[model samples]
Target chain A: EPEVTQTPSHQVTQMGQEVILRCVPISNHLYFYWYRQILGQKVEFLVSFYNNEISEKSEIFDDQFSVERPDGSNFTLKIRSTKLEDSAMYFCASSEAQLEAFFGQGTRLTVV
Target chain B: AQSVAQPEDQVNVAEGNPLTVKCTYSVSGNPYLFWYVQYPNRGLQFLLKYITGDNLVKGSYGFEAEFNKSQTSFHLKKPSALVSDSALYFCAVRDMQRGNKLVFGAGTILRVKS
Candidate 1:
Protein backbone atom coordinates (compact mmCIF):
# COMPACT_ATOMS: atom_id res chain seq x y z
CA GLU A 1 0.00 0.00 0.00
CA PRO A 2 1.11 3.58 -0.64
CA GLU A 3 2.37 5.38 2.43
CA VAL A 4 3.18 8.91 3.49
CA THR A 5 6.95 9.46 3.74
CA GLN A 6 8.82 11.95 5.91
CA THR A 7 12.46 12.91 5.60
CA PRO A 8 15.05 13.16 8.38
CA SER A 9 13.52 10.63 10.72
CA HIS A 10 15.37 12.38 13.54
CA GLN A 11 16.78 15.86 13.83
CA VAL A 12 18.87 17.68 16.40
CA THR A 13 18.96 21.44 16.23
CA GLN A 14 20.31 24.23 18.39
CA MET A 15 17.94 26.48 20.19
CA GLY A 16 16.90 29.57 18.22
CA GLN A 17 17.97 27.95 14.97
CA GLU A 18 15.69 27.39 12.01
CA VAL A 19 14.39 23.95 11.09
CA ILE A 20 12.31 22.54 8.32
CA LEU A 21 10.55 19.17 8.31
CA ARG A 22 9.66 17.64 5.00
CA CYS A 23 6.95 15.22 4.00
CA VAL A 24 5.74 13.58 0.82
CA PRO A 25 2.12 12.63 1.13
CA ILE A 26 0.39 9.99 -0.92
CA SER A 27 0.40 10.96 -4.57
CA ASN A 28 -3.35 11.06 -4.99
CA HIS A 29 -4.14 12.73 -1.68
CA LEU A 30 -5.71 16.17 -1.86
CA TYR A 31 -5.57 17.25 1.77
CA PHE A 32 -2.44 17.36 3.94
CA TYR A 33 -1.88 18.11 7.59
CA TRP A 34 0.80 18.53 10.24
CA TYR A 35 0.46 17.48 13.86
CA ARG A 36 2.84 17.27 16.80
CA GLN A 37 2.96 15.17 19.91
CA ILE A 38 5.05 16.22 22.85
CA LEU A 39 6.62 13.40 24.78
CA GLY A 40 3.88 11.83 26.87
CA GLN A 41 1.28 14.27 25.56
CA LYS A 42 -1.66 14.13 23.21
CA VAL A 43 -1.28 14.65 19.51
CA GLU A 44 -1.96 18.31 18.69
CA PHE A 45 -3.03 19.61 15.34
CA LEU A 46 -0.86 22.25 13.72
CA VAL A 47 -2.14 23.08 10.30
CA SER A 48 -3.96 21.71 7.28
CA PHE A 49 -3.11 22.39 3.67
CA TYR A 50 -5.14 22.02 0.52
CA ASN A 51 -4.88 23.44 -2.95
CA ASN A 52 -1.29 24.45 -2.19
CA GLU A 53 -2.40 26.77 0.61
CA ILE A 54 -3.25 26.63 4.23
CA SER A 55 -6.87 25.74 4.80
CA GLU A 56 -6.92 25.91 8.55
CA LYS A 57 -4.62 26.10 11.54
CA SER A 58 -4.81 25.63 15.25
CA GLU A 59 -3.69 27.95 18.05
CA ILE A 60 -0.52 25.90 18.37
CA PHE A 61 0.35 27.00 14.84
CA ASP A 62 1.72 30.42 15.66
CA ASP A 63 3.75 33.01 13.81
CA GLN A 64 6.95 30.98 13.96
CA PHE A 65 5.44 28.11 12.02
CA SER A 66 4.87 27.99 8.28
CA VAL A 67 3.83 25.31 5.82
CA GLU A 68 4.45 25.11 2.13
CA ARG A 69 3.66 22.82 -0.73
CA PRO A 70 6.55 23.89 -2.92
CA ASP A 71 5.99 21.10 -5.42
CA GLY A 72 3.37 18.60 -6.36
CA SER A 73 4.80 16.01 -4.00
CA ASN A 74 6.67 17.87 -1.25
CA PHE A 75 5.09 19.51 1.79
CA THR A 76 7.23 21.25 4.37
CA LEU A 77 6.89 22.78 7.83
CA LYS A 78 9.40 25.42 8.83
CA ILE A 79 10.06 26.88 12.23
CA ARG A 80 11.84 30.18 12.26
CA SER A 81 13.47 29.69 15.65
CA THR A 82 13.35 26.45 17.49
CA LYS A 83 12.37 26.49 21.13
CA LEU A 84 12.99 23.84 23.74
CA GLU A 85 9.26 23.32 24.05
CA ASP A 86 9.13 22.57 20.35
CA SER A 87 10.90 19.29 20.84
CA ALA A 88 8.46 16.62 19.85
CA MET A 89 7.44 14.10 17.22
CA TYR A 90 5.99 15.84 14.16
CA PHE A 91 3.67 13.80 11.97
CA CYS A 92 2.53 14.43 8.43
CA ALA A 93 -0.77 13.05 7.23
CA SER A 94 -2.82 13.04 4.06
CA SER A 95 -6.34 12.18 3.07
CA GLU A 96 -8.05 11.73 -0.26
CA ALA A 97 -11.40 13.05 0.88
CA GLN A 98 -11.14 13.57 4.65
CA LEU A 99 -12.89 10.31 5.60
CA GLU A 100 -9.70 8.46 6.52
CA ALA A 101 -6.20 9.78 6.88
CA PHE A 102 -2.81 8.07 6.59
CA PHE A 103 0.05 9.36 8.70
CA GLY A 104 3.78 9.20 8.17
CA GLN A 105 6.21 7.58 10.56
CA GLY A 106 6.95 11.05 11.97
CA THR A 107 10.07 13.16 12.48
CA ARG A 108 11.53 13.33 15.95
CA LEU A 109 12.95 16.78 16.60
CA THR A 110 15.25 17.56 19.46
CA VAL A 111 16.13 21.13 20.40
CA VAL A 112 18.98 21.86 22.74
CA ALA B 1 -14.98 23.00 18.72
CA GLN B 2 -14.60 19.24 18.36
CA SER B 3 -12.84 17.01 20.88
CA VAL B 4 -12.43 13.39 21.96
CA ALA B 5 -12.04 12.03 25.46
CA GLN B 6 -10.59 8.68 26.48
CA PRO B 7 -11.30 8.09 30.14
CA GLU B 8 -9.03 5.12 30.75
CA ASP B 9 -5.30 5.55 30.73
CA GLN B 10 -4.67 1.81 30.58
CA VAL B 11 -6.73 -1.35 30.29
CA ASN B 12 -5.40 -4.82 31.07
CA VAL B 13 -7.09 -8.00 29.87
CA ALA B 14 -6.05 -11.61 29.55
CA GLU B 15 -5.57 -13.15 26.15
CA GLY B 16 -8.75 -14.59 24.62
CA ASN B 17 -10.86 -12.31 26.80
CA PRO B 18 -13.03 -9.53 25.52
CA LEU B 19 -11.77 -5.95 25.74
CA THR B 20 -13.30 -2.54 25.40
CA VAL B 21 -11.70 0.92 25.28
CA LYS B 22 -14.01 3.78 26.06
CA CYS B 23 -14.14 6.99 24.03
CA THR B 24 -16.39 10.06 24.24
CA TYR B 25 -16.55 12.87 21.77
CA SER B 26 -17.88 16.45 21.63
CA VAL B 27 -18.70 17.91 18.29
CA SER B 28 -21.21 20.20 16.70
CA GLY B 29 -23.28 18.84 13.81
CA ASN B 30 -22.82 15.19 12.88
CA PRO B 31 -19.77 13.47 14.40
CA TYR B 32 -17.33 11.43 12.40
CA LEU B 33 -15.57 9.18 14.86
CA PHE B 34 -12.47 7.08 14.32
CA TRP B 35 -10.18 4.62 16.10
CA TYR B 36 -6.46 4.40 15.56
CA VAL B 37 -3.69 2.18 16.92
CA GLN B 38 -0.01 2.84 17.41
CA TYR B 39 2.82 0.40 17.85
CA PRO B 40 6.06 1.32 19.57
CA ASN B 41 7.92 4.08 17.74
CA ARG B 42 5.39 4.15 14.92
CA GLY B 43 2.82 6.51 13.50
CA LEU B 44 -0.90 6.27 14.09
CA GLN B 45 -2.55 3.53 11.99
CA PHE B 46 -6.18 3.83 10.99
CA LEU B 47 -8.37 1.16 12.53
CA LEU B 48 -11.99 2.12 11.89
CA LYS B 49 -14.41 5.01 11.62
CA TYR B 50 -18.11 5.78 12.07
CA ILE B 51 -19.50 8.26 9.59
CA THR B 52 -23.12 7.28 9.32
CA GLY B 53 -25.47 4.36 8.77
CA ASP B 54 -25.00 1.47 11.22
CA ASN B 55 -23.77 2.27 14.69
CA LEU B 56 -21.48 -0.75 14.85
CA VAL B 57 -18.33 -0.19 12.81
CA LYS B 58 -15.82 -3.01 12.30
CA GLY B 59 -12.18 -2.34 11.67
CA SER B 60 -8.82 -4.03 11.13
CA TYR B 61 -7.29 -6.60 13.48
CA GLY B 62 -10.65 -7.87 14.63
CA PHE B 63 -11.44 -4.58 16.28
CA GLU B 64 -14.77 -2.78 16.22
CA ALA B 65 -16.36 0.36 17.61
CA GLU B 66 -19.93 1.31 18.39
CA PHE B 67 -21.10 4.88 17.83
CA ASN B 68 -23.65 6.16 20.30
CA LYS B 69 -25.07 9.49 19.28
CA SER B 70 -27.15 9.88 22.41
CA GLN B 71 -24.17 9.57 24.73
CA THR B 72 -21.84 11.32 22.29
CA SER B 73 -19.46 8.39 22.47
CA PHE B 74 -17.74 5.89 20.19
CA HIS B 75 -16.22 2.97 22.05
CA LEU B 76 -13.82 0.42 20.58
CA LYS B 77 -14.29 -3.27 21.31
CA LYS B 78 -12.65 -6.58 20.55
CA PRO B 79 -14.18 -10.03 21.00
CA SER B 80 -10.98 -11.86 21.93
CA ALA B 81 -7.85 -9.99 22.83
CA LEU B 82 -4.40 -11.13 21.79
CA VAL B 83 -0.90 -10.37 22.99
CA SER B 84 -0.27 -8.65 19.71
CA ASP B 85 -3.13 -6.27 20.52
CA SER B 86 -1.09 -4.65 23.26
CA ALA B 87 -0.55 -1.13 22.06
CA LEU B 88 -1.65 2.49 22.38
CA TYR B 89 -5.06 3.31 20.98
CA PHE B 90 -6.54 6.70 20.22
CA CYS B 91 -10.02 7.96 19.52
CA ALA B 92 -10.65 10.90 17.24
CA VAL B 93 -13.57 12.96 16.05
CA ARG B 94 -14.43 15.31 13.22
CA ASP B 95 -17.53 17.12 12.10
CA MET B 96 -18.80 15.83 8.80
CA GLN B 97 -19.83 19.27 7.62
CA ARG B 98 -16.76 20.89 9.13
CA GLY B 99 -13.12 20.87 8.16
CA ASN B 100 -10.68 18.00 7.80
CA LYS B 101 -8.73 18.30 11.01
CA LEU B 102 -9.39 15.52 13.51
CA VAL B 103 -9.44 16.05 17.25
CA PHE B 104 -7.78 13.15 19.06
CA GLY B 105 -8.17 12.02 22.62
CA ALA B 106 -5.31 11.53 25.02
CA GLY B 107 -5.04 7.78 24.33
CA THR B 108 -5.60 4.39 25.91
CA ILE B 109 -2.86 1.82 26.46
CA LEU B 110 -4.27 -1.67 26.09
CA ARG B 111 -2.28 -4.63 27.44
CA VAL B 112 -3.46 -8.09 26.50
CA LYS B 113 -1.49 -10.41 28.68
CA SER B 114 -1.17 -14.18 28.51
Candidate 2:
Protein backbone atom coordinates (compact mmCIF):
# COMPACT_ATOMS: atom_id res chain seq x y z
CA GLU A 1 0.00 0.00 0.00
CA PRO A 2 1.12 3.55 -0.66
CA GLU A 3 2.11 5.46 2.45
CA VAL A 4 2.74 9.03 3.54
CA THR A 5 6.46 9.79 3.81
CA GLN A 6 8.25 12.26 6.10
CA THR A 7 11.88 13.34 5.88
CA PRO A 8 14.46 13.76 8.63
CA SER A 9 12.97 11.13 10.95
CA HIS A 10 14.76 12.99 13.75
CA GLN A 11 15.91 16.57 14.20
CA VAL A 12 17.78 18.48 16.87
CA THR A 13 17.91 22.25 16.84
CA GLN A 14 18.75 25.21 19.03
CA MET A 15 15.87 26.80 20.88
CA GLY A 16 15.84 30.02 18.83
CA GLN A 17 16.52 28.47 15.45
CA GLU A 18 14.05 27.90 12.64
CA VAL A 19 12.96 24.37 11.69
CA ILE A 20 11.07 22.94 8.80
CA LEU A 21 9.43 19.50 8.78
CA ARG A 22 8.63 17.96 5.44
CA CYS A 23 6.00 15.45 4.35
CA VAL A 24 4.93 13.84 1.12
CA PRO A 25 1.37 12.73 1.50
CA ILE A 26 -0.22 9.96 -0.51
CA SER A 27 -0.20 11.00 -4.17
CA ASN A 28 -3.97 11.02 -4.63
CA HIS A 29 -4.94 12.54 -1.30
CA LEU A 30 -6.48 16.02 -1.22
CA TYR A 31 -6.73 16.96 2.43
CA PHE A 32 -3.56 17.32 4.51
CA TYR A 33 -3.08 17.72 8.23
CA TRP A 34 -0.41 18.16 10.89
CA TYR A 35 -0.56 16.77 14.42
CA ARG A 36 1.92 16.54 17.27
CA GLN A 37 2.45 14.27 20.26
CA ILE A 38 4.43 15.28 23.26
CA LEU A 39 6.17 12.37 24.94
CA GLY A 40 3.64 10.24 26.81
CA GLN A 41 0.81 12.60 25.84
CA LYS A 42 -2.17 12.51 23.56
CA VAL A 43 -1.69 13.49 19.96
CA GLU A 44 -2.81 17.03 19.30
CA PHE A 45 -3.93 18.60 16.08
CA LEU A 46 -1.89 21.49 14.75
CA VAL A 47 -3.32 22.49 11.36
CA SER A 48 -5.33 21.25 8.45
CA PHE A 49 -4.61 22.33 4.88
CA TYR A 50 -6.67 22.02 1.73
CA ASN A 51 -6.93 23.89 -1.54
CA ASN A 52 -3.47 25.27 -0.79
CA GLU A 53 -4.81 27.22 2.20
CA ILE A 54 -5.21 26.51 5.85
CA SER A 55 -8.64 25.12 6.66
CA GLU A 56 -8.30 25.15 10.43
CA LYS A 57 -5.66 25.34 13.09
CA SER A 58 -5.33 24.75 16.79
CA GLU A 59 -4.07 27.31 19.30
CA ILE A 60 -0.72 25.57 19.30
CA PHE A 61 -0.39 26.58 15.69
CA ASP A 62 0.35 30.21 16.38
CA ASP A 63 2.10 33.05 14.58
CA GLN A 64 5.40 31.22 14.61
CA PHE A 65 4.05 28.26 12.72
CA SER A 66 3.22 28.09 9.02
CA VAL A 67 2.57 25.38 6.46
CA GLU A 68 3.25 25.46 2.74
CA ARG A 69 2.72 23.10 -0.13
CA PRO A 70 5.70 24.47 -2.02
CA ASP A 71 5.15 22.05 -4.90
CA GLY A 72 2.59 19.43 -5.89
CA SER A 73 4.19 16.71 -3.80
CA ASN A 74 5.88 18.30 -0.83
CA PHE A 75 4.14 19.84 2.16
CA THR A 76 6.26 21.62 4.71
CA LEU A 77 5.71 23.04 8.20
CA LYS A 78 8.03 25.81 9.22
CA ILE A 79 8.52 27.15 12.71
CA ARG A 80 10.04 30.62 12.67
CA SER A 81 11.54 30.41 16.14
CA THR A 82 11.54 27.10 17.89
CA LYS A 83 10.81 26.85 21.59
CA LEU A 84 11.58 24.04 24.01
CA GLU A 85 7.88 23.22 24.17
CA ASP A 86 7.92 22.71 20.43
CA SER A 87 9.83 19.49 20.86
CA ALA A 88 7.49 16.64 19.92
CA MET A 89 6.77 13.99 17.32
CA TYR A 90 5.14 15.78 14.38
CA PHE A 91 2.87 13.65 12.23
CA CYS A 92 1.62 14.30 8.72
CA ALA A 93 -1.66 12.83 7.59
CA SER A 94 -3.73 12.89 4.41
CA SER A 95 -7.17 11.79 3.35
CA GLU A 96 -9.23 11.44 0.25
CA ALA A 97 -11.86 12.95 2.47
CA GLN A 98 -12.24 13.13 6.26
CA LEU A 99 -13.09 9.73 7.69
CA GLU A 100 -10.03 7.90 6.40
CA ALA A 101 -6.73 9.61 7.06
CA PHE A 102 -3.36 7.96 6.45
CA PHE A 103 -0.47 9.02 8.67
CA GLY A 104 3.25 9.32 8.15
CA GLN A 105 5.77 7.78 10.53
CA GLY A 106 6.41 11.22 12.11
CA THR A 107 9.36 13.57 12.61
CA ARG A 108 10.83 13.73 16.08
CA LEU A 109 11.83 17.30 16.94
CA THR A 110 14.19 17.97 19.78
CA VAL A 111 15.03 21.50 20.88
CA VAL A 112 17.80 22.40 23.30
CA ALA B 1 -18.25 19.25 20.13
CA GLN B 2 -16.85 15.76 19.39
CA SER B 3 -14.68 13.55 21.54
CA VAL B 4 -13.46 10.00 22.16
CA ALA B 5 -12.75 8.25 25.42
CA GLN B 6 -10.55 5.24 25.94
CA PRO B 7 -11.43 4.09 29.42
CA GLU B 8 -8.38 1.97 30.04
CA ASP B 9 -4.82 3.23 30.15
CA GLN B 10 -3.51 -0.29 29.88
CA VAL B 11 -4.87 -3.78 29.25
CA ASN B 12 -2.87 -6.95 29.83
CA VAL B 13 -3.72 -10.26 28.26
CA ALA B 14 -1.98 -13.55 27.64
CA GLU B 15 -1.03 -14.81 24.22
CA GLY B 16 -3.77 -16.97 22.57
CA ASN B 17 -6.42 -15.29 24.72
CA PRO B 18 -9.07 -12.85 23.54
CA LEU B 19 -8.49 -9.16 23.98
CA THR B 20 -10.59 -6.04 23.96
CA VAL B 21 -9.84 -2.31 24.02
CA LYS B 22 -12.87 -0.24 24.85
CA CYS B 23 -13.76 3.04 23.18
CA THR B 24 -16.73 5.35 23.45
CA TYR B 25 -17.47 8.56 21.62
CA SER B 26 -19.76 11.57 21.58
CA VAL B 27 -20.76 13.53 18.50
CA SER B 28 -23.53 15.82 17.36
CA GLY B 29 -24.12 14.09 14.09
CA ASN B 30 -23.45 10.78 12.37
CA PRO B 31 -20.22 9.29 13.70
CA TYR B 32 -17.34 7.95 11.65
CA LEU B 33 -15.33 5.85 14.07
CA PHE B 34 -11.90 4.31 13.63
CA TRP B 35 -9.28 2.18 15.38
CA TYR B 36 -5.53 2.59 15.00
CA VAL B 37 -2.49 0.87 16.49
CA GLN B 38 0.98 2.26 17.07
CA TYR B 39 4.20 0.42 17.74
CA PRO B 40 7.03 2.20 19.51
CA ASN B 41 8.64 4.93 17.41
CA ARG B 42 6.14 4.51 14.59
CA GLY B 43 3.12 6.36 13.29
CA LEU B 44 -0.47 5.22 13.80
CA GLN B 45 -1.66 2.38 11.61
CA PHE B 46 -5.25 2.25 10.41
CA LEU B 47 -7.21 -0.80 11.53
CA LEU B 48 -10.88 -0.33 10.71
CA LYS B 49 -13.64 2.23 10.44
CA TYR B 50 -17.39 2.43 10.87
CA ILE B 51 -18.96 4.76 8.32
CA THR B 52 -22.51 3.47 7.74
CA GLY B 53 -22.57 -0.25 7.77
CA ASP B 54 -23.31 -3.33 9.78
CA ASN B 55 -22.34 -3.11 13.41
CA LEU B 56 -19.31 -5.30 13.02
CA VAL B 57 -16.23 -4.17 11.06
CA LYS B 58 -13.23 -6.45 10.56
CA GLY B 59 -9.80 -5.05 9.85
CA SER B 60 -6.08 -5.70 9.62
CA TYR B 61 -4.13 -8.06 11.88
CA GLY B 62 -7.22 -10.06 12.80
CA PHE B 63 -8.75 -7.09 14.56
CA GLU B 64 -12.44 -6.22 14.59
CA ALA B 65 -14.61 -3.52 16.12
CA GLU B 66 -18.29 -3.44 16.92
CA PHE B 67 -20.06 -0.12 16.57
CA ASN B 68 -22.93 0.16 19.00
CA LYS B 69 -24.93 3.25 18.12
CA SER B 70 -27.14 3.23 21.19
CA GLN B 71 -24.17 2.74 23.46
CA THR B 72 -22.03 5.19 21.50
CA SER B 73 -19.17 2.72 21.60
CA PHE B 74 -16.72 1.17 19.16
CA HIS B 75 -14.76 -1.53 20.94
CA LEU B 76 -11.85 -3.27 19.27
CA LYS B 77 -11.46 -7.01 19.68
CA LYS B 78 -9.20 -9.84 18.71
CA PRO B 79 -10.09 -13.51 19.04
CA SER B 80 -6.59 -14.73 19.90
CA ALA B 81 -3.96 -12.22 20.87
CA LEU B 82 -0.30 -12.50 20.04
CA VAL B 83 2.77 -11.01 21.67
CA SER B 84 3.26 -9.07 18.48
CA ASP B 85 -0.05 -7.34 19.19
CA SER B 86 1.48 -5.48 22.08
CA ALA B 87 1.21 -1.81 21.20
CA LEU B 88 -0.69 1.39 21.83
CA TYR B 89 -4.23 1.57 20.53
CA PHE B 90 -6.21 4.69 19.76
CA CYS B 91 -9.86 5.21 18.99
CA ALA B 92 -11.08 8.16 16.96
CA VAL B 93 -14.35 9.68 15.92
CA ARG B 94 -15.25 12.09 13.14
CA ASP B 95 -18.40 14.12 13.07
CA MET B 96 -19.70 14.73 9.60
CA GLN B 97 -20.78 18.25 10.52
CA ARG B 98 -17.27 19.01 11.72
CA GLY B 99 -15.70 18.16 8.36
CA ASN B 100 -12.76 15.76 8.24
CA LYS B 101 -11.01 16.41 11.52
CA LEU B 102 -10.71 13.35 13.75
CA VAL B 103 -10.96 13.44 17.53
CA PHE B 104 -8.73 10.77 19.05
CA GLY B 105 -8.76 9.15 22.46
CA ALA B 106 -5.72 9.32 24.68
CA GLY B 107 -4.80 5.77 23.68
CA THR B 108 -4.61 2.41 25.46
CA ILE B 109 -1.47 0.35 25.89
CA LEU B 110 -2.02 -3.35 25.21
CA ARG B 111 0.49 -5.87 26.48
CA VAL B 112 0.21 -9.45 25.34
CA LYS B 113 2.28 -11.83 27.38
CA SER B 114 3.40 -15.40 26.75
In model 1, which residue pairs have backbone atoms overlapping below 3 Å? none
Interface RMSD of each: 1.4, 1.4
Q: Where does model 1 exceed 4 Å of error?
A: B96-98
Best by TM-score: 2
lDDT of 1: 0.91
lDDT of each: 0.91, 0.92
Q: Pairs clashing in candidate 2?
A: none
lDDT string for model 1 (B1-101, tens) is 78899999999999999999999989888788899998888899999999889999999999999999899889999999999999999999864443488
Q: Of the candidates shown, which would achieve the greatest DockQ relative to the real structure?
A: 1
Task: Please state the CAPRI-style docking class of candidate 1.
Answer: medium
Error of 2 at B58 (Å): 0.2
In model 2, state the lDDT of residue A12.
Answer: 99
